[model samples]
Target: MELDLLKEAFDRVAKKQKQSSSKTLDIVNQIEKEIEQAITKIQTTSNHTSVLTELKDKLNELAPMNQLDSNQKDINLALAKYTKLLEKCFQPDISRAYRNVDTDPHVLNEIISTHFYRQGLFDLGDCFTNEAREPNAASLKLPFVEMYQILESMRERDLEPALAWAAKNRGPLTQNGSTLELKLHQLQFVEILKKGNRDEALKYARTHLARFAATHKGSIQKLMACLLWAGRLDQSPYTEFTAQAQWEELAHELARQFCGLLGQSYESPLEVAISAGVQGLPTLLKLSTVMAGKKEEWQNMKQLPVALDLGREFQFHSVFVCPVLREPASEENPPMLLPCGHVLSKQSIVKLSKSSTRPFKCPYCPSEATISQCRQLHF
Candidate 1:
């Protein structure tokens, strides 16, 4: 709805601008034509005084100044209206939303440099780190560099580099429930099959893919079925197996698994932070406006007054809300694991135990435990 309003305003401004331009152009052209005709008459005829008087009369009759003033007035009115509409719709002043907080410059520089490196912008990362006097930040680029190299190889349908990396990290990849290695082998087997080499495709599959048969029986069966349409998989019932999306998805999966093994997130941390900030900015701005006079309270707040829906991607951890108190757990009142395997806020446990002087029955079970038996849990 807001976009529609903006578009409507923009269209009005554009229409007015075009109309004003056309009108001004017509008036200028008319004036120029009159002046040219007057000059020609003056040059041909010896009556220069008469031509001058006639030209002066023609110029006054055209009234170029009046027409231009009218056009300018209309343009100014439209511009002023458009400017006000923009200001009203955008609420451009964001100064009131800002809150001053101290941040470590070194950490911020590192994050910026790391973001560049993770994006495969090694030169830019190096330049930034050098300019920031943190040359050690360049060390972060090596891992991402190798990741991109493998991705480049995969883009060329050569999965040797990726397969090697996957094999080297097989243990960790298995722990993380990743089948990147098997998927790479499947892509390779399909490539060989596309060459109309049934024997070689079967050989490759048996050598690399047979081990995954026990766990991935269904996928192995599909690969085996693809042998019937060797060199013509595109015409086969499993046509989707040859789609570009397969390679793209595999690349994404490989990058995800690679980042996981590096103890990093699949998405860039800087990108996630910026995206979350953008999502929550409007709420923060409104809250800042409402708390204008209570700036101290706003600044001291550990959590936002309202929940920001940053979506699933930004949700990195679980938020345990205590059922007994009907409030979320915080550092001051963290969730505690009771002996009965039920969880409750520390405050709720203290209240239930009567200040730790007595035992209390579990809120959800028949078992009882003292506050001492409840352990602090960190999520």
Candidate 2:
């Protein structure tokens, strides 16, 4: 909405300037005509003083110049209004301050430096850590460096490094139900077949792809079919195996697995958070405006009035909101399952429990249970 307003203001200012320019051009043309007439009259007349007097009288009319001046003043007024509007639009940024969440500065710095590390900005991360005296940053560099090396090799269609990394981290990958190892080996096999190395490709597939036969039978069968068109894999029925996009996908998959093994995100969390924050900012600003007089309510509210839908990429996990409290569960107020199998936040459980002494009645059912029976539930 603000952008639209800015665009409208710009257009208005542009139109006003255009009008002023047109008026100035008209005034100049009229003055030139009057000068030409005066020159003609002077060349044709014997009495130069009278001709000059008549030219002066015509010049003194000055209607066109006055109109141009009026137009210019209008333009100036429009510009001033636009400038004031812009100032008003930007004023909220100064007046409205977000309530700080009490996050530790050191932790935030570490997170920011790690974000740089995850993005392969080793030099920048190093500079930041060295300048900030972060000891932990020293250890953070090597792992991401190695991960990037493997990823870079994968991008170059050199799968050896990726295969090695995947093999070394096979246990964790399997635990995460990732098929990156098989996919890497499959990519390697496809490259061999594309190069017309049918014998080597079959041997490699038998040696590596056989292990995943039970889990990826269809994919394995499709890979095997590529052998029939060894010399012309591009024209094969399973031509996707030979496409460069496959290598790209494999590289991304390998990187995702690598990060997953380290208990990190495939995309940088900092980026995701920023994107979500940007998406939610307009809503927050509007809400702030609506609650301008109610500063205490704005500051004290625990939950947002509207949900920010940041799409699938930004959603990392499931969120549970307590029906009774109508507030989302957090670490401090985690979801708890009652003995009767109904769930509510821990704080809600306490409220419903109403003093730890007596048996608490379940809100959903007639079943009664002690506070101890309400176990914390993890999502």
Candidate 3:
């Protein structure tokens, strides 16, 4: 009886193994048949457009054909080859495939879907190591190579140059232009910030947010988003930006949002850190004071980017709305007097105070103190 039972167990195991092997072979055969058919059709094709269409249609039908157990490596290899063929045939138009990943991006841009097939979208700022193993990855080779080296030299805090350049370049990206170029810029910008340039990253974000707001007036979300991004740059663009009327409102809004830490983390270098000369310091102090009142209101209004200039990362930092106060010193330079008890040869407090809303409160202390209560930091 024992001998008979052991023999029966062995027979059962053999049968199971045979069934598994059979299923795998069936799938493998299917894959080979499909690939052979595609290859023959592709070979007979003539026009590049026709070739691309055939390849695209076949991809549409057979793509993600991941069910075939034995065809995994073969399918990957085939896709690599197929993608390469299309790339070579339509050098400029090949990017049109990558366009939807950018062209009609999702509201949140989740970046994953059945529609996403191009491998280039994954090339987010990874340097080309010239891995001869896969020639398939050499998509972004051009003036972008020149720009990448330039960006590597700048400090993390100063990557705006790269983003600005990329944003500007997005305009002419078409059949003749390189989409990879702008893509590299956005990727590099994000990488640099994630590494260290947190402030610049915020600025990059705000600029994009503002540009979006201007384009899609309905997107209040984008407006708040700019505030959130600028909150990261914490460095004041107050003086330079406030020189214009429309920008003044945006600058004030941004400064208020940033000070409150809206849509940002305190540990993220979007800190309250700032640079203030005697003239600039008061504006910051006043801003701080004014913002102390309605902190929650600003926090609730995080802006989102509008669908403006779809491909280009729109980067207008401030919205144009209200007139700003940037009066020059009436007299060349005067013995500076301030309620802050600091003095310099900059300008008189009387005229400077006129630039603010509540000329009643000293910018430094919001105190009702006059020049009598002041001291001179620099004589």
Which candidate comes out best when scored by lDDT?
1
Q: Which digits, one per residue and each the tens of the lDDT, describe model 3 over residues 1-379?
A: 6446545555555555566567667766755776677678678866556655665676566544554444445445545555555454433322211112235433222222101111222344233223222333333333334343433433233445544554554554333344333333333344444345556756654655445455445543422333433433224332222123433333233223322323322121211112112223333334434554646222222321121232222222422211122232223443445555434333445444444333444444655544444443422
lDDT of 1 at 253: 95
Model 1 — TM-score against the truth? 0.76
Model 2: lDDT of residue 285: 73
How would you encode candidate 2's per-residue C-alpha lDDT over 107-221 as one tens digit per residue?
8878889899999999999999888888786687788999999888876778898888888989888888888888888888888988899999999998999989998899998
Question: What's the TM-score of every candidate structure?
Answer: 0.76, 0.70, 0.16
What is each predicted model's overall lDDT from 0 to 1?
0.89, 0.83, 0.40
RMSD of model 2 against the true structure: 8.0
lDDT for 367 (candidate 3): 56
- Global CA lDDT computed for model 2: 0.83
RMSD of 1: 5.1
Q: Which ten residues in a row have the lowest lDDT in candidate 3?
A: 109-118
TM-score of 2: 0.70
